[model samples]
Target: MYARKPVIVLLGLAVCGGLGCAQPPACREGQVATPVSAQRHPVAGHHLRAHAHNDYEHERPLFDALDHRFYSVEADIFLNGGKLAVSHRNLPWDSKRSLEELYLEPLQARVDATGSVHGDGVPFTLWIDLKEGGREIVDTLHAVLEKYPMLTRVDGDEVLPGPVTVVLTGDDKAKRDLVTRHSQRRAVRDSNDYSPEDPPADSAWGYYALRWGDYLDASSTGQLDASQRARLACIIENAHAQGRKVRFFDAPDHPDAWRVALEFGVDFLGTDDLRSLDTFLDGAP
Candidate 1:
């Protein structure tokens, strides 16, 4: 499915999907000459806008997404036997692959060892998709996160500068309780779609996640029509004006949709194809 385009100059590989394409095209000569090239960061030329959706499903889990330099990575978790287990759907629980083991522990260990999670010491988002056990999961998460205070902080409304910012999602009531009930917690709550129920954009805590197709028809229709592009612009503009970062989830995972996202100034580019997004950003201006 990926035997078309050749790898572009300065970009190491032209990726097709998560599995990557056959090495038909040769890698371009020389490394991408971004300003960070002089620095020692591993993901030197990576763009911070990329977001890894269902990151735990990958072969190397967090490391795979980190290798791509995605600014945000998400995992679905369930509270089982008082432990947070990382899994997409409710199935036979695996204690060995708990949230702590897959995400928190690795994150903390990496920061302790290198003083950075992404090799650049830059702060990034760790999105936790809470599946079940509502309050239990939220509480469990808070406790686990507290130990790594330096990496994940909590000071009332402010999270402070930290290596990672943990965002809680799922079960609107549970997420709200974490905020309204605690009054002071280290974690942040994911906002609902912009509506009367949701906090004002200025008051929105973490991010505004919406359906990409709702704004732009480009996903199914190939490229966005002029009107569709305008709709996207309006939505993005509205969110930003309210001081909220914008993300379009469930968008088409195609390159065409990705281009429109950049054009609309999207804050997060959600995709399962890390390699393709990584390749796209590497070659993009």
Candidate 2:
């Protein structure tokens, strides 16, 4: 029992460390020495929001990126029956990992846990890429969102019941347009077929999410082909003209894509590996 006592104490310390506890400050008598300044963590600005595509499929789920302090995360959603399920495909949607359970719930917990805000002012963006078609999913999501007041439309900038900023992503431009027209919520155009000219007058597009199919392969880097690049540049310029940002995804998950995206002045580069993207943005060469 005597030897076992030390083992128990060590185990407790390990558990504490895993839960993000810091060591206690040393002191002398009743007075303590001046404490060192807390190290300032880097702020992820409009550079690249780390995206965990189909995060629910990962063995560890969203916790891995959250534990590493990822600024943004992505979860694909599909409408199965009346529930908003979290999955890449509609055929095998898991009831256990609903959109609320896998994405919104954990995210809400994080915002509650951190109490951190953008610029200590803006709400954190939760990018939801929809996989299935129909107004049913949108309605279901809207209903779920209504329950959580912290989430508000970015246009209003009001503090809702939650601190998450929800952005919808989908391939169906017409459907997305219909949702935006009826509701006041914000949505992004994630299609290669659509252009700025066709954008709605009161475009709810706060950001443009480009996929892997949208880019062309360069010698050693990923880029939009000549015509595609020109068109994208124009779209981005026009989008910015309307106070919107541009984001790209499905590109190489390495320094190559990061370098190109930065050079092109993209607002966000989506990646599955948050740590790598974070490091690259921090000037990893």
- State which candidate has the highest TM-score: 1
The CA lDDT of each predicted structure is 0.67, 0.54
Clashing pairs in 1: none
Query: In model 2, which runs have C-alpha deviations exceeding 4 angstroms?
Result: 1-42, 45-48, 91-93, 117-122, 154-162, 171-178, 181-203, 212-217, 223-235
State the number of backbone clashes in model 2: 5
Task: Please report, as a residue range, the 10-residue window in candidate 2 with the lowest summed lDDT.
Answer: 1-10
Backbone clash pairs for candidate 2 read: 149-160, 149-161, 150-160, 150-161, 150-162
lDDT of 1: 0.67
- TM-score for every candidate vs. truth? 0.78, 0.67
| lDDT (Cα, 0-100) at 253 in candidate 2 | 67
Candidate 2 lDDT over residue span 1-285, tens digit each: 001111112521211223443222112123322212112234544332455555666666777655544555677777777888777777665667787877677666655666643334335667777776666776777668666545654333322224666667764654475356545543333443334444432434456666543333233345434433444455445555556566766666667666656655566566776667767665632
TM-score of 2: 0.67
